[model samples]
Target chain A: MTRPGGRSARVRDAVHEAVVELLAAGEIDAAIPKIAERAGVNPTSIYRRWGSRDHLLLDAAVTRLRAKSPIPDTGSLRDDLLGWAEGVERSMRDRRGQILLRALVATMAPDEEPVEYLRARGDDLQNALDRAAARGEPVPTVDEVLDFVLAPLYLRVLFRRPVEPGTAARLVGRLLTALPADPAPRAGRGG
Target chain B: MTRPGGRSARVRDAVHEAVVELLAAGEIDAAIPKIAERAGVNPTSIYRRWGSRDHLLLDAAVTRLRAKSPIPDTGSLRDDLLGWAEGVERSMRDRRGQILLRALVATMAPDEEPVEYLRARGDDLQNALDRAAARGEPVPTVDEVLDFVLAPLYLRVLFRRPVEPGTAARLVGRLLTALPADPAPRAGRGG
Candidate 1:
């Protein structure tokens, strides 16, 4: 509580907590002044650190959401994907997370321009796919993973559509079915 | 140039044009009074007809966007989906449409509560699926269509990721592969 670095970190944590609490309460249009007040941090200090409300809110939201979405390691691609999907579904049920996702979606630019917020999300999915490949399982390309698995989940979340319990399983089943068949090596020389 | 019972309709059209023009110019936070001034419609009239800025923006955006996304009637499902995807890609390239989508995303309540703007979009996709079924083409379920076809398309539009030229074709190819093989009827009954 006393060290300089530790105090700064604590201030950051308090700010994140304050923003999340406000956003969860449905204050989608809450201002930086209110957030600073709630956090007990000086307004000038917040502005100096985050530069803008967008940057501050995005950081707080991403930090909280990323913590809840740790990749699972179940030793198989199917189980791993299903677990990850379920975890995401559970996480999506949080109103605060939905608010964050909506903000990220609204703020992102068109394709061909990089947005760190969205890219970080893709990285989580990519990490799961990489683990599957390391286990000798046939893996789809990252684009395929995004298209087949993650995109629908996001759509359902963003649209406020009910994601049935079996939705993720069904998606994984479809993705696996569409995967390229593993090529067999030559049994003998080119007789 | 409008007929009888058309004065209000003309006013609506003018308002829509003004809103679209302002939004396309990146005035995302533009207010209704400004919009009313631009459209030559009284502020009271705009407020009476559209209730809120969200409603007016959504109405204007939807009216403009729906006209640009006509369903394709190509001979085959492959051709049809590819054509539809291309049409959507073209439509998304419009800065105005992107702004509208972003606003819609930010404003939609969670999935348990249906929003008319989002539902209208699903109707368009469902129409295409219904057409394919009428043609005896193998059609994926609405959920599958949302996941495989629409999700990736939305992701590309929302995020700044590069969408390859053949992205839609590739998605369709994978989707077709995942579809259940057509079940053949038994030639011989219980003889």
Candidate 2:
């Protein structure tokens, strides 16, 4: 019954690392016992820390991939947003990340906890925009910009098309300039 | 194997109708065998036509819900685009249609055929704009306009929030006004 921290922290990190490797290698259906053995942890430890195989795998994937790379704070909001869009385009270009996202989308139900966790990551990205807006930067609601800025990247990755150079930046530039000088304040705004 | 025509067509229609009923009743999983039984066809027949359970359900849903709604051409491109946006907002507000879209998103992978089918539906809406442009209407790329115009709607649906009334029309209006005016036709270009 070791907790997540004590001696189990090392084991948990090892298990997470193993899951990422397996997922990247397209071994999604690899046996759970094999993962535990590879991580040098008892299967019970995994089950104790993560309730099910899906939860463990999803958590591992999220932890490994969830770096909040900073959004640029260029003097102009337009430039900053375009910069963020470029970053998104670059991330979607990574084959492993694309595969991971596609796998999650295929298996995760919209109402399920794993999907919620994935959405929380999306929310974190939106929160960064909100942070910028709170600093007196002119910007539209996160939802308004989210799809336009991100869809091309998702479309490219999911459809197996090349992310056309400058497409993301162009979209971000267009949307930012198109936004009203001051968007209507969001209801119940909070980061 | 009998094709869907004559009596078989009627039976297929009946089965698809029953599936819609079950889905509306929030019994998607229970609808499958019942649908086959009601249609007097083998469950395998449904599976054969639709591939998987989710596919069968979604195709049935789309069959029931598909509409050839009109896009307005009110002499002004801005007005026409705004009208189209309003139509999209209306369709998304349709309770049954929303349920079907939600179910499809939940069950399909981002790159899976079902998801692609849904994306194609969205793309068709964009294509209407393309058609208008090709008819010498003054507009930028339909794909670009679509990205901005539908951004908020998609975000709201995917994030499980109610879209604000008038938001669609306002977005379309804003985008139209923000766009650069059509370039003046080349002078003295008598064909």
Candidate 3:
């Protein structure tokens, strides 16, 4: 079993950190060789662990995206989703967020689904919904939140559509009024 | 002045057809040089026209995606959307549609929004909504259709999520009932 803070874990962390640094430094196109060098890890090991540069890039982006936007526990489904959606909108409007999203799209393949972002986002949504459920409030399934709230916002940003002022709140409001009641707290999203 | 059937237009068609052929033949990883050669055009000319292979691929995919899924005119919003959404769903479930979507994402950048697909899809939606409005039916904005109908479908497919049977109909149903009364048929989607 891989221990916490073990060599493998450390290496992974270091590589992820390097990726973030590179991205922050405006090197969105940095290659694995450059990242491995920065992380002081072997590129070969990186390939062994992550499979491809796209995978590695996406994994790091997911980490950064999640690290910033922890699911808020506002004690109400409405407030929690609004907060999270606003955070998502803000990030997507920024330079780094745009790059991360681009990397997310870049990593996607027909045969292989990118796991890092989906798993992390799913867990975050589930955690928020679970908290709302425990507080005796109704909660939408993860899939509903994904489609109704997340997809619309993210799609708008990715396509460079104009995100009107307070659009996130509008979307959140519409979602709360329209969807939900599934209560399948950890219900599966699309496959 | 670029004429409809002039050299510029002909070269573009040839290159796009070449891209579709290569993708259909399982050359998903084919490069520009190869594409240019296959199209019987110089690689430099391709770079001059499209700026990148990703752009060319996306342009071609958009053309294909639009060509197959012409928006229906059933004299009503609900039926038209259902018909069109079904076509989109059927295509996205196939191998070629998968590649086309992948190419769509690949071409997306922070600064440069891919124009071909969005323009075509927007026009298709607008045409359908216009028809609906003319028939005295309440029509959701084109943005509404894009966010509710198109984004959900495409995102699910790209993420390898199982689009449950009849989900397209469900989304279209939600779109019709959940939104509308804003007869601004050409209202812009969020940026």
Please, what is the whole-model Cα lDDT of each candidate in the order they appear?
0.70, 0.61, 0.78
Taking all chains together, each candidate's TM-score versus the true structure is 0.84, 0.69, 0.83
| Rank ordering of all candidates by TM-score, starting from the highest | 1, 3, 2
**Each candidate structure's count of clashing pairs:** 6, 0, 6
Model 3 chain B: worst 10 consecutive residues (lDDT sum): B182-191
How many Å off is the CA of B143 in candidate 3? Answer: 1.1
CAPRI quality of model 3: acceptable
* lDDT string, candidate 1, A59-172, tens digits: 887777666665577888778777776666666766667777776665453332455565566677677777777777887666665677778877877777766676667777
After the best TM-score superposition of candidate 2, give how far the Cα of residue B29 lies from its true spot, in angstroms: 6.7
Per-residue lDDT for B67-94 in model 3, tens only? 6677777877788889899988888878
User: What are the per-model DockQ values?
Assistant: 0.39, 0.19, 0.42
Candidates arranged by lDDT, highest first? 3, 1, 2
Clash-forming residue pairs, model 2:
none
Per-residue lDDT of model 2, residues A1-191, tens digit only:
12467776788789987776776676766667878988888888888889777778667656544542335667666666776677666666676666665554444444443124435556655666677677776666555565557654554454444566787777777667766677566643221
Question: Clash pairs of candidate 1?
Answer: A110-B160, A111-B160, A112-B160, A160-B110, A160-B111, A161-B111
**Chain A TM-scores, candidates in order:** 0.79, 0.75, 0.78
Predicted structure with the largest DockQ when compared to the true one: 3
